[model samples]
Target: MTTGQMARAAEAPYYYVPPHSIYPIRGSLSMLATLLGAALWVNDFTVGPYLCIAGIISMLVTLYGWFGDAIGESEGGLNSKRIDVSYRWSMTWFIFSEVMFFSAFFGALWYTREVSTPWLSTLDSQTLLWPGFAGTWPNLGPAGTIAPFKTVSPFWLPTINTALLLSSAAAVTVAHHALRAANRSRTIFWLGLGILLGFAFVACQAYEYHEAYTELNLRFTSGAFGALFFMLTGFHGFHVIIGATVLSVIWWRVVRGDFTATHHFGFEGAAWYWHFVDVVWLGLYVFVYWM
Candidate 1:
């Protein structure tokens, strides 16, 4: 072969090195806009909502481009086994960090219910400090500072959502198995079903939120109970949306023949994330809802 042809046929490097990209900077700026806009919006600023929407759009665009680049690299055989191992470790740590994130919120909920509220109500100075205060799991604060609000029950909607998420988990697992078996059609079908189930879960949650705000009169300002309730569930809902989006992208890639049975770390990574989300939802169902 000619020298030029030989050069062209050279194997990829042992470790793929990606060039510098502006995706990170763009992502950071997008998050900044989102957080700042949300803060201002909560404080009743007029322009906050628009800025928040803009930020979300910007972030989505950035992620699209970033993932596109990664997909290109993988498809072009730039990623070696070493690179794949690195990706796995990175995802592992990312999931671990998410575990800690949820732990903090769950710990707060536990502390409020088991320790803080009970201790405050039991204090000898309570009579002088705040009369007519009752130590309750869903306290409306002393002297009724917060309006009366009912806590959500886990009977119908939450239960239904739980089932939907569980089914989605199962569907994704089936899809993974199909991919391993090199059954592309079955994989696509199951993945699509999983994405649908995810959307259904989100829809159910949205309806639940509407019921809380409209019928039950519960809101973010409804004392500690409301605060913790929204914090936990809202964050979980955000994660569900994110997980669904990730799965949708993976589904698209699968459709484009981006993965093979033996080499689909992208698919595996997304599946791992989806499973993590499912497990977290189970925890929420037990502690946040049923409890």
Candidate 2:
């Protein structure tokens, strides 16, 4: 054999091909169970809540095992440079998909406010179709089926949450820099602070929801305004929760010295997701609240 070929053969394989796994099937089944159970529970089925809990538990366990395998593969140096590049591209596309997802909701909100409302107001049949109906933003329907709910203003809680989320973005950026500089201690500290800020944002949002429901009578069924308001904010809040959880896991990995300055795509991926969450919240603050 050639000298170079012999040397290459003596070294580890250049690429690590993962074996087929059942994680995807398990995950899908868990999600199906969770959705089915949630639907049934909402309809007051007796066994629905139990099934929902079981599904959630099973999903969590599956994730634990799946991530454990990934960690083992990564730490064992099975990932090649090609694999790292693939991971980066995968994360990029994932975030882009998320952007598109939010865009659809924002588009709906815009069309309802700018297009549909004005068009309906101009229709000659509107007066006859719904007496005393005004085609204004935040309308409560023609029949007055919805209660007189107040809209949430961008004064206190939302502003606070905005500040918290922005601060978290900054914190995570700093942590990323620290990680790149090989300062693991500083990285962990900043990441922890970022996580705390994320939690604070979630808490403030919960308080806002409480005030909206209890004090202002704002709710999911109040009208288009209420539905869009809750739908946008609620989904963003869910993303925040997920981003925080991912960061927490990344922080734990950092504590265990699982990443280095040159090879920490896992940390970078989580940071990307958190930053995307922060940006989405900014858009929400501007369009949903201030507008």
Candidate 3:
């Protein structure tokens, strides 16, 4: 065994389990508060936004503490091979759940476009309910209901974001390889570049939203197209933000010598999430933008 492995085996138990903690309940309560606040916010309650922000803050704090403790345990050699395997499985299932979540939105878009919209066009009630109401993919409702809004074209901004995400994925892959090779400097360089590219993608997306609102008049209420447009892209952007945050944390850990060549599950987990985000963005770019 290598010196690092020998040291870890000597210091760590065969299978270590942590003591009872409050993180689960705290996280659950925070999520409940956030959901309640969202319900109220949608209903136009005055205190809704404040409560939502507070809940988000509480959730962030809970996550910080929980992950911090986990990091400490790993650094202190409390995490054994068994714990590492469990963590890998946990991350795998987490990414699978995310895939299912995105799949739901994609399914919604498909149903609306191919089945419901076309079916509505052929329905006899369309002529009775509203004369000359063409059931198009981006129908503006019965005349004056939805304002006319231009759809976002896949031009400079979204295309740029796609390139950025793709490049970041490549960079991170290189970083992972470098880490395996024990090239800390190269890993840091490439990983940092990847993280920056991710943030750049987010920035580009924010600007795209700004343009959609101000210039194109495309919004959540413009039409079904508008609503689905924002829902898919916005949620994907949120995932990008989350993936970037996780990668940033991993980058910090790498800088501090928190990972070794053979036992870097944390870094691997973060990379997996980043790759998932990249793949989701590609799907969004194709379906939402091109289609």
Query: Candidate 2: minimum summed lDDT over ten consecutive residues — where?
Result: 1-10
**Greater-lDDT candidate between 1 and 2:** 1
Per-residue lDDT of model 1, residues 1-291, tens digit only: 233422332444568689999999999999999999999899999999989999999999998899989877777667767777899999999999999999999999999989988877866748667766788888989888999899899999989999999999999999999999999999999999999999999999999999999999999999988998899999999999999999998999899887778778889999999999999999999998877
Clashes within 3 Å, all models in order: 0, 0, 0
What is the C-alpha lDDT profile of model 3 across 1-291, one tens digit per residue? 346753785466678879999999999999998999989999999999988988999999999999999988877767777788789999999999999999999999999889877776765856757666687767787665999888888898989999999999999999999999999999999999999999999999999999999999999998788988999999999999999999999999899888878768889999999999999998988998888
Off by over 4 Å in 2: 1-13
Q: Please provide, for model 2 over 258-279, each residue's C-alpha lDDT reduced to its tens digit, 9 standing for 90 to 100.
A: 8878778899999999999989
Candidate 3: where is the Cα deviation over 4 Å?
1-13
In model 2, which residue pairs have backbone atoms overlapping below 3 Å? Answer: none
CA-lDDT, candidates in order: 0.89, 0.89, 0.89
What's the residue-level lDDT of 214 in candidate 3? 97
Which sections of candidate 1 miss by over 4 Å? 1-13
Better of 1 and 3 by TM-score: 3
- lDDT of model 2 at position 117: 74
TM-scores for all predictions: 0.93, 0.93, 0.94
Give me the candidate number with maximum TM-score.
3
